[model samples]
Every structure is written in structure tokens, then in C-alpha cells.
Target: MAAGGPPPVLGVDACRGGWVGVLLALGRPSVALFAPRAAELVARAGAAAAALTVVGIDIPVGLSAGGPRQADLLAARELGARRSSVFRTPSRAALEAPTHAEANARSRAAGGEGVSAQAYALRTKVLEVDAWLRDRTAGPRVVEVHPELSYAVLTGAPARHPKRTWAGSEERRAALRAAGIELAGDLGEAGERAGPDDVLDAAVAAWSAARVATGAARSLPDPPEELEDGVLAAIWA
Candidate 1:
């Protein structure tokens, strides 16, 4: 750790075990392939994670825009993202990146359909998940992820996995891999996408947490309760 620097974030690809990757910003490339469920990821880390600061997730923490209702409008206003806009189901670009066709299939299995009968299942779930973490902690900067931007932040260019979109399978996985996902093992399976997305998003959120901790990415938007705590911990940890 650098002097006067917060602890490094654990950037997780949130994929399957085979592709379940973990990268800690403790310096040096500490990437790996150990797939763990989200609850397990937290419980397993136990005191260690509690001791740290942030968690970024690649999953949607809020619901998607279903037509244009009040909540949808409010959410869009809050994130500053429009309904069905580029950030629409922001995870789309993450999942459809362009490497693993398998991840898209698996992500669908995780309940995120490529389309919709009502609202986007995954997006709805993001709202639930976001609420879940918000309800649980007084610490850890927990936030939704937009991997296209995440890759941009990490690599300073559109370099992650070939820049994909939810429009198709080929593009999604490519982008997921570029974001550091694996195509065969843990990330390749169906049951793992939930935890994988959560973990990776947590990682990115953690990175943002790091920036805030360093007093570098100084931007603020009256976030939900406890979210700021998570971000600060992720950065300081």
C-alpha cells in the first residue's frame, strides 16, 4: 500500500469459478479464478472484507425503465441516465462485451432475459439487490456498474473486451471477458452469474470508492444511506 493511500479494492469479474476472477489493487496483478457466491464472497471474506472499504458490482442495483412510469422517471433522473438509453440495463454492455457467448447464456439463466414480457427481469432484480445491500450495511460503498465506463476507467480507453452490447450474444461475453471474466469455469456456468455480476460490480464500485478515498475523483451526489460508507471503506481499506 502506498503511504497515505487507502487499502486497494478487490476487483472481481463476478463470473463463474473457471472465469471467476479476483484482482486486488494491493499493487501487482493479483488476478485469479476462484468463483464464489455473493453472500459467500462476503461471508468467506469475513473480517478481512469488513476490515477493508469498498465493493463494486457489475449487476444493476436499480430497476429498469418500463415504458416511462414515475419510479422509472425518478430513477433515471437520479442516475442521470435515460430509460432504454445507453445505460439502459447498463449491464447489457457488460454482459454483451464480445468474448464469451457462454456468459450471455448464463446471465440469462441468472434471470436476466435478453428481452422482456414485462420489465427487464435483471433490471428489476438490480433494484432488489441494491436495496438488499443498502439495507444491510452502514459501511462499504456499494453501487451499480456500467462496465463500458468501468473499462474506460481501468484502461483509459475502450479496451476491456471489445466493447459489446446486449443486442446479441457474441458482443456481450466479449465485453464481460474484457472486463476480466472467464468463459469456461465458474463464469461459464448458469448459477454463477448472479454472484459474478455482484462481485465485479462491487469491484468497480470499490475502485470508485478508492478514488473517493484518495480524494481524487471528487464528485458527489447525495447517495442513498450507507452507500457512502461502503465507498469510503472500499477506498480507505
Candidate 2:
């Protein structure tokens, strides 16, 4: 058989009890939830590996040892009041802690501003993706994405309400439509399948994956940083 064409783009968002993934391929969108692990999630998205191009996720990748990552800083500056959406990623050392208290302590010891309870809650998920990327032989095409950042770009203004609210979800849907992304299926239905916020974030991630594949997306740091352990760190939208 002839070599396959580029892989389709995928967008993933962490959900209530698992992860929500959106696969946009051949102009079709499919959603799935992966609770077992991040590796399984990526594998599902890469079922057609030869055709996989970009995988966008709403989680922190490539961490900073001290202070905030260049990408987080940039995202905060652009997001204004909504900047809290961009949580500071903990250093690898800090992530070794087994508890929120320990992680916060470790984060401070590592020279960061200390991990928040919100950031601590995501430790397992972040570590899952971090470990998955570390073990990938071909390196991962994964990019960090913030749905709010994508929405801001789409609407030319910061989001006014939380994504969990009906108003926020509608705003997101409007932004998606404004960006020209086709939502063939009902967004509310998609949210029912996962969560309103999760589905919406995944949709934005998928849209960003398309942008990355087309070279139209801009990353926070322009050129991303590659950690010595093979993690590529950058937030794109």
C-alpha cells in the first residue's frame, strides 16, 4: 500500500472523572473518554497513526524548575482577569510528592511560587501525560493548549463567565462558530456524553490542532522549549 497521508488532528481535555478526546479526521469529529490512562487515550487518537498530525491537550506539558514558564506568563498577560485559567505547572521534582501538602512544599523547595490546591489536583493527570510522552519512542506531537486562550483569539475578547455555566457554554459555541469550525452534532449532546466544559474544551483543542497542522497557530513562546527528558513545552492556540 502507498504510504498513508498525515494523521488527523486530536484535541483532549481533562474531564470530571477522566479525559475527553476529540478526533477530527476526514472532516468528521468523534469524541471519546479515557479514564484508564493518558497512554490509552493517545493510542485511541492514533488508531490511524500514519495519519496523525497534532495532538492538543489542555494540560501543562514541559515544566519549569523555578518561577513560571514563559508560556504561562504569556498566556496570563493575554488573558487578563481570566489568567487564573493558566495554572503554573510544578517542576518535575515537585511532582514527586504524593500529597497536596507535600507537593506544595516540594514546589516551593524547587524555587517555584508553590503549587496551589487547584494545581495539586491535576498532579496525577499531568504526570500521566508527562510519563506517556517520556516513553514515546518517536517523540510526541502533543502541544499544550488552553481553551480560554483559543476562545479569546476566536472572539477577540476574554470570556466573561465560567465555562460550566449555560451562558459560558453558549459563548464558547458562538466562538467556535465564529472561528468557522463545523459543529455538525449538537454541542449539548456532546457535553452530555462527557461534560459541558470538557466537551467545549476538547472542541477548542481540536480546533487548535487543526491550526497547528496548518501552521496558523501561534505558540506562547514562539519556539517551544524541549526539556532534556524529551518533553516539548509550549502552549499553542
TM-score of each: 0.46, 0.87
* Residue 119, model 2, lDDT: 83
Backbone clashes (count) for model 2: 4
Candidate 2: the clashing residue pairs are: 6-51, 7-51, 7-52, 8-51
Please write out the lDDT profile of model 1 over residues 1-237, one tens digit for every residue. Answer: 234446644443344332232434443332333433454454333343335455545554433222211222333443332223223342333233333454345445545544332224343334445556656755555544344444345545443233222242344444445544433444333334435344444444445555544555422122321322242111111
Taken over the whole model, the C-alpha lDDT of each candidate is 0.40, 0.76
Runs in model 2 lying further than 4 Å from the true structure? 1-7, 29-35, 48-50, 182-193, 226-230
Tens-digit lDDT track for model 2 on 1-237?
012322477789987667777766753444444545666767877774446788899999886665667888899889999998888777877776888788888777767777888888888888888878767887347888999998887678899998889999888988876655545455443355577678778878888887888788899887877655565678898
Worst 10 residues of 1 by lDDT: 228-237
TM-score, candidate number 1: 0.46
Candidate number achieving the greatest TM-score relative to the actual structure: 2
What CA RMSD would you report for each candidate? 10.9, 4.0
Off by over 4 Å in 1: 1-4, 12-36, 46-50, 64-87, 90-128, 160-206, 218-237
